[model samples]
Target: MTESTGGIDMDEDSSGTVKKFAFINRKAPYGTVYALESLEVVLISAAFDQDVSLMFIDDGVYQIKKGQGTKGIGMKNFSPTYRALEGYDIEKLYVEKESLEERGLTEADLLVDVEVLSRADMAALMEEQDVILSF
Candidate 1:
C-alpha cells in the first residue's frame, strides 16, 4: 500500500465505485484563467456523475463572493452560476478559515453557503477523497 504523507490511503482501486473528487481552487476569479477553468472542470466532473466537491483557498474564495459586477469589464459575472451547482449534484463546497481571515472575508461575504474548515481539517478531508485536482 502506498501511503501518502498527506495520510491518504490510495491502495484501493475505486474504478466502479462512486468517485470522490476534490477540486482545490486557489486563484482569484479574474485577472487569471484558473477560476474559469476550475468551473469548467466542475461541470465536466458533474456531468460524469462523479461526487465532486470544491475547496476554495487563498484568493479563490473571491470567486464565490456575492454581488460581483463584471459588466464594467465587459465580462458576464459568473458568481450566480455557483448557485446552480446544486442542480448538478455538486454540493460539497469548502473554504479555508485562514484564507478567509487573510483576505478579511467572513462567511457572510460568500455567495453560497460553504463549510469553513481549518487547514488541518481541510487536509484530512482531502486525504479522504479518491482524487484531488488542484487549480
Candidate 2:
C-alpha cells in the first residue's frame, strides 16, 4: 500500500522571494509632491505585506519635524501622518545623522522616533536591501 503525493513541486521554478525594500526620501514634505508620494507608496507596500523601511536624508528629514504649521499657506501639515505608520507595521524609520546635524535638528524635534545612522552605516544598510526606492 504505497501512498502517492498529488501536488506538483512549484518551488523549483520560483524566483526566490519578494524583496525587502528600503525607501530613501531626499526631499522635503511640503512645497513639493515627493514626500506625499513616498508616503503613499509606503502604505501600499505595507498593505501587500512587503518588508519595507524608510530613510530620510537631506531635506527629507524636515518632513517629520514636529510642530509644522502649514495652515497659514492654506495647506494642512501632514507630519502627523507619520505617527500612523506604526499601526501598519512599517516601523523601520531611519534618519541620517549627518543630515540632522547639518540642519541643527535633534531627534526630539522629529515628529516620530527614528533610528539615527551615520552616512557610512546607511550606505551599508542600503546595500543589504533587495530593492531601493528614492524620492
Candidate 3:
C-alpha cells in the first residue's frame, strides 16, 4: 500500500522504513540551477526522516569549494548551506577524488568536510542507495 503526500511517497506497510536517497550533483554551482535544486531536494528528503546522502562529482565538486566569489556573477553564494546540513542530520556527503584532482582542488579547498571517494568507491556507494536522484 503506497500513498503520496506532499510529493513524498508513503508506504503504509513499511511505515517506518527509511529509504536511502542519494543526490548526485554533477554540474557547476553558479551558472545552472542544478546545484540549488539538488540542495533543496536533499533538505526535503532529510525533513522526511529519509536517509539522505550527497555525492558531488565532475564539476559539482565546485559546489562546495571554499571562498566562492559570486559577487561578479550577481548570484548569491549557496555554499554555506552545505555546512548547515549537519544540523539536519544530512552528514553523509561524498566527493569524487578524481574530480577534485582534475580540478586541482584538495579536501582543504572545500568549505565543508566530506569523504573523498575514488570512482570505484563512488559507484559502490551509488549501488547501495534505494533511490538515486541525479542533478
Candidate 4:
C-alpha cells in the first residue's frame, strides 16, 4: 500500500498500475498561483511514474508563451520551466487552437513545442484521461 503524508501518497512505486494524469491549465501564468501550482503538481505526478500530460486552454496558453516579460510586474518569468519538462519525461503538451487564434498567437509564439488541437480534439483527449486535475 502507498504511504500517505498529509493525504498525499508518498510511495511512487507502491501502485503497480500506471494511471494517465491530465493537467488542464485554463488560467494565465501570473496574477494567480494556479498556473504555477499546476506546473508543480504535473512534475510531482511525473516523478510518480504516472502518464502525465498538460493541456493549455484559454489564458493558460500564455504560461508557455515565449518572450514573456515579468520583470516589469515584479514577477519572475517561469516560462522556461516548461521547456525543462522534457527532461522529466513529461512531454505530452497540448494547446487549444481556438484559444491561440483568439489571442492572436501561433505555435511559434510558444516557448516549448506543443501539439495544437481543436476544441473537439481536446475534448476527446480529456475523455481518455484516468484522472484530470484542472487549474
Candidate 5:
C-alpha cells in the first residue's frame, strides 16, 4: 500500500502501478488552448496519485513568465496556477536552458522554481519517464 500526505492512495491490489508522467510544454500561452490544457492534465494526473513532472521548452517557457497581464489581450490570465503545483504534490518542473537563452530570458524570468537543464540532460530526463506528453 502507498499513501502520502498529498491525499492520493494506492494499495497493493493495484499492483503499485504509479507511473512517471513527464509533460513537455512547447507552446506559448494565450494563443491557443495547449498551455492551459496541459496544466489541467498535470493537475489531474497528480491528483490521481501519479508521479508527474512538467517541462517548459520552446515558447512554452512563456507560460510561466512572471507579471503576465492578459487584460491587454482580452483574456484571463492563468499563469498564477503554476505556483500551486506543489500543493498538489507535483513539484518537478524543468526548463530548457537553451530555449531560455534563445529567447533572451533568464531563470529569473519564470514564475516558478525549475531546474534548468541542457538539451542533453533534458533528453536523459525524457528517457526516465514511463509516459511523455507534449503540449
Candidate 6:
C-alpha cells in the first residue's frame, strides 16, 4: 500500500493499484431494481473503507425523497434505508440541483441531508473518481 490523500492507506489489489469509487443513480425508486440494488452496493462498498461518493441525478433524486409510500403499489418502501448510510460512514451524497428544481422538489423534500451540486460541479466530482458505476 502507498500513501493516500489525507494519509489514508492506498490499497493495492491483485494488480497492485488503488481505485476510487463513484456511484451514479439516475432511475426512479421502486419502478425497477436499480435504486434498491444501488443502495445495497453502497452499503457493501462502505465496508471496504475506501473513498466512496454517491451522486443522484435525473429521476434518481426520488430515491431519497421523503414521504415515500408503496402500499397502493404492493411494494415495500426502501427509501428509509438511506438514513442508515451515515452510520456506515457513507456521507458523501450529492444531488443535482437542476434535477431537483426540474421535478419541483426542494432540499426539504429529501429524507436525508445531501450536498446539492450544479451540473458542472457534479461533472467535476465524477471526473475525480477512478471508477464510476451508474444505475
Best by lDDT: 3
Write one digit per residue (lDDT tens) for candidate 5, span 1-135. 112122333566665678777889999999989999999988888767887889888999999998999898998799999999989998999999999999999999999999999988988998897777778
Total backbone clashes of candidate 5, pairs 3 or more residues apart or in separate chains: 0
Q: 1-135 in candidate 2: lDDT tens per residue? A: 011112323375734455577888999877799999889888887876667889999999999999888878888677888999999999999999999999999999998989999999988888887667778
CA lDDT for candidate 3 = 0.88
Record all residue pairs in model 6 with backbone atoms less than 3 Å apart, i.e. clashing: none
Comparing 2 and 5 on TM-score, the stronger one = 5
Best by TM-score: 3
Given candidate 4, what's the lDDT at residue 49? 84
Give the residue spans of candidate 1 off by over 4 A.
1-15
| Colliding residue pairs in candidate 2 | none
**What are the models' TM-scores?**
0.86, 0.86, 0.90, 0.88, 0.87, 0.86
Worst 10 residues of 5 by lDDT: 1-10
Q: Quote the positional error of residue 42 for candidate 6 in Å.
A: 0.8
Clashes of each: 0, 0, 0, 0, 0, 0
- Regions more than 4 Å wrong, model 3: 1-9
Off by over 4 Å in 6: 1-18
Pairs with steric clashes in candidate 1: none
- Model 5 residue 3 distance off true place after TM-score fit, in angstroms: 30
Per-residue accuracy of model 1 over 1-135 as CA lDDT, tens digit each: 223223333456744567777889999988888899889878887876777889999998989988899989987688888999988888899999999999999999999989999999988998898777878
lDDT of 6 by residue, 1-135 (tens): 122222333445424344677889999998899999999989998867777899999999989999988999999899889999999998999999999999999999999989999999999998898777778
Cα lDDT tens digits for candidate 4, 1-135:
122111333476757777777889999988899999998887787778888889999999989889888888998788888988999998899999999999999999999989999999999999898777878
- Report lDDT (CA) for all predictions: 0.85, 0.84, 0.88, 0.86, 0.87, 0.87
Model 3 residue 96 distance off true place after TM-score fit, in angstroms = 0.7
